[model samples]
Target: YVVEELDVQNSIYEVPLELARQELDVKTLDLLRLDRRTLDLADYLAWLDGVLHPTRECTIAVVGKYIKHQDAYKSIYEALNHAGIANNAKIRFLKVEAEELEKGDPARILKEADGILVPGGFGGRGVPGKVRAVEYARTRKIPFLGICLGMQCAVIEFARNVLGWQDANSTEFDPDTAHAVIDLMAGQRGVTEKGGTMRLGSYPCRFRPGSRSAELYGVSETGERHRHRYEFNPAFRARLAEAGLAATGTSPDDRLVEVVELEADHPYFIGCQFHPEFKSRPRKAHPLFNGLVAAALQHRQGR
Candidate 1:
């Protein structure tokens, strides 16, 4: 088998998000080039091709630490597959060792993917890799779908790389980022272990007007089930927004954050503080999952 020479530089481009938007050179965007021979710019389409089945598809790398128990993430995987089938495509799932990503170059595996998803996990054992992958997506303008811890990593990635917050971190992992973007809830009690002390179950979210999620679910305010403990620190919301990151969806009382999308521009970059997969069915896929698959399809067609 002939191996393709890797684009090590593609690991992370330092282009400002807006500049990346202006220049069509980024790998994640449409790889279309002008057809000088004909003097008419042609829309170069990259078919899902060999990668797709009856349901055309793109490979999406799901980098996380909990691959051992597919059941722990079963709902999530199935929901993605459901979306693929509904859209006449298959959602490719790849589980990777987070430490491998952190210790060395993960650009190869990350680049092979049409999208990257960072799911929830506990402890700091594999968080840096998750954050690294988020950085890959953010800078490259890749179709990124972050959930729970994934959302936290997306925030941490933006905090450190774009906003210049040096010690950005989740309190779940470290209590000491210069700015603590994540922290434990103050009102909780009855702890058996640090493991189970999280806020779980269903919660309400108040959406910002004209947000991507607000339009997808057909309402500004909505409810979704969750199985997590740590929440975004309420104090950092404004700081994050000022830096162009949005806590677009929040709880009814506005105490808990629910979803975050790009402030503006880019196709489908969304991170949710909740797992919508738990409620997705084979027939009716969750809107969030549907949205992610849609982005992958767009990326595959060189858009």
Candidate 2:
């Protein structure tokens, strides 16, 4: 009589999986692989030790309103993990409510952060707090990365604080606002349908030759996934650029700004319209995430 056990937890087949007895024997029933690459266990063990036992850890604060549900930013979390692995460091996320930032000093709340991440989201619920957090990162010289709506909030903050546009805001939040630093895309003009009408999927962003975004990406042109209807207003681009908030990347036809970055005066402050997290993989970390992690590591070491 023959008995079959699936061994679902251990993932073992008909036979048990054990360490090879010194050297693998082809005739042995416990052999797991037929290739030499699989037999090289020494290098694998070294890699495992280094990765599993990182020398240092970092705390990156994710300032957003959806902290109650992590799944809202699952891709961003995974991308940060991928970047952590690439840097051989452990990353811990500190969830900060955006509403709190508006009520008080963001520096006090984000004081423990090795880096600050402002993720994408819709609506005007916690925008003031997000702007405050961006202000904290910018003024404190902390490593900062803003995505999608985060980018818009950064623009609003810059317009208000730097460009003197006291009432700067996004059209999505206040359609009648005087200074709409972020406005609805041209194609989305007067579109009543809200379901899946955003500029979704992959789109190419042309980077400036010597810009920070290009340097981090190591390419002049790259495509990233985007899911948004609002974008940086072209009318305010010149003012923002003249004030040092340069548009480092733009759409293929140069009709839309895809990336904005502070100059060399700042340690690392960048914002992107595309969601870089969606492209990150376990083995392949996205450049934007990798850059953020690296900058965070540097910031931690310097302190």
Candidate 3:
């Protein structure tokens, strides 16, 4: 009925609003004598307009193993949209299958991307491809944001290539690798149950005073949700930091690394162990995503 009666271009919210205005009577408000000014939706409509119509565009290559499934990374996709809306740009996702990146040239596949993002995931099936994507983004100075396992891959790539740890890997992928840059949290080793075993829910992260993570967030501390067990092994923190992969955010006690970034020369290379997408909303984009989209716009213009 809406498609046939109302302008097809109207927003879904606008359609309902128009229907109420056209079909419903104002007698109810009149009888109650409620001020009509209270029902003003001008600000909301303007914001909706911005979301529906962006002025610019940027392509983001989302490297992941489950790209074939639409709902697999639904939150990540939606968060990117929110970020795009915040930046006044349409986010065009180039869903590059992680397994495909394992065999294909990442440079060629990702050359057109204004930004590169690798969302959270489990297993080791296409880790090599994800690492390759991280490497490309890091080397090319392209805007990059890695979440959860994506952050782990970023550390592994940096350790292997920059730190000269050729076999650097996450214990989740290589339980016996000599260089376990990423390891299961000490508290999680004894867990046998698959359900409710991983580190989950919101946690506070204290950002380093001058780090990019803190700068982007505009605060020294913030809470972000998590859904992973493996973490940046503290044993390799100094080594990694010496090579430029700095742990810029950590747990309140400084026992766990929550955020990592290469802030020296890179435009925007950040990885967060927590799932920032979980808290993102259309009206307020997460800072990490906001920064990535803004950096992507800059990268696009530079190209």
Candidate 4:
């Protein structure tokens, strides 16, 4: 009214209260049930609340570069929730910025973390921090899950600290590094275009017979979503395997490394090139997430 009185030009209109109320009423009816079922909104909401707000809680630190914008890892966060609900525990996600871990010991920052997850991302902005977190989890025997670039960090950390490769790094980070432990995938080579060029969508991975990943997944062959151009360099596969980083899963032809895991003694340290979080559901959590949550519960109990 004041703007109108001042003779101000504006392209805005107020919605009628009756019209808004009618729209709300229609939406409410539409959302009352999932399908033509007897279950109502109230009952569903109550059940959902109970599942989400559990008595037991476990803290899982998600160490990543994009800590400020969580939507980058939205699927991963939800996967944790699904796994938490499955185990009757509430997931308390701690967003640990990668830049902070580079400065000093992550112990001070991740002291209370029952589990540590290094999810997918690109670039070298916080790579050092992530590598430190991987080392912490490895030596401390804390439950850990590394996805995509997280897996690359684990390999790089192992190469530098365990295998004594001082100058080891991903080609994606340092194209002229002495050792390009992680480099561009064969299919993605010589591609100048960045958009939609990644090895995206579902791909199959075959698990080794008695590997921890096989046990966790309860299957030899399975598929998961991927969005990456870089892959574990095949040239260094022998050295990585000799250093005790078991190549648990691989591509159909066994040329590409899909999953890497530590020995049985490390509790639950597993990393995958694919994104298991993409397929995770509220009722049925991804096996990797489920295992991580379960291990976290045990870690908390021990601590």
Top-TM-score candidate index: 3
Displacement of residue 224 (Cα, Å) in model 4 is 0.7
Q: Residues 1-303, candidate 2, lDDT per residue (tens digit)?
A: 122222233222212224343333433534664444334334434444445677777989999989888588888889998888888889999889999888877768998999999999998999999999998998888999999999998899999998898999998888888999999867777678985458899999999999988998898999999998898999889989999899999998998999999884777899999999989986688998888989999999999
List, in order, the clash count of every candidate structure: 4, 0, 0, 0
Which runs in model 3 stand beyond 4 Å of their true positions? 1-37
lDDT of 3 by residue, 151-231 (tens): 999999999999888999999888999999999777788888855468888999999998999998999999999888789
Residues 1-303, candidate 1: write the lDDT tens digits: 112232223212223322434443433333454332211111111122212343477777888888776677787788888778667787778777777789777777676777778888777888889888888877777788899989988888888887788788877677666778887777654576865786677888889888888887778887788878778878888878887888889988877888988775677778998988888876677888888888888887894
Worst 10 residues of 1 by lDDT: 38-47
Ranked by TM-score from best down, the candidates are 3, 2, 4, 1
Q: After superposition, how far is residue 202 of candidate 2 from its true place, in Å?
A: 0.5
* Candidate 1 residue spans exceeding 4 A from truth: 1-55, 68-70, 189-196
C-alpha root-mean-square deviation, each candidate: 16.8, 6.5, 4.7, 10.7
Candidate 1 at residue 32, lDDT? Answer: 55
TM-score, structure 1 vs. true: 0.78
Candidate 4 is scored at a TM of 0.83
Find the candidate with the highest lDDT and give its number: 3
Model 2 spans > 4 angstroms off: 1-47
Worst 10 residues of 4 by lDDT: 1-10
TM-score of each: 0.78, 0.86, 0.89, 0.83
* Collision pairs in model 4: none
Candidate 4 off by > 4 Å: 1-53
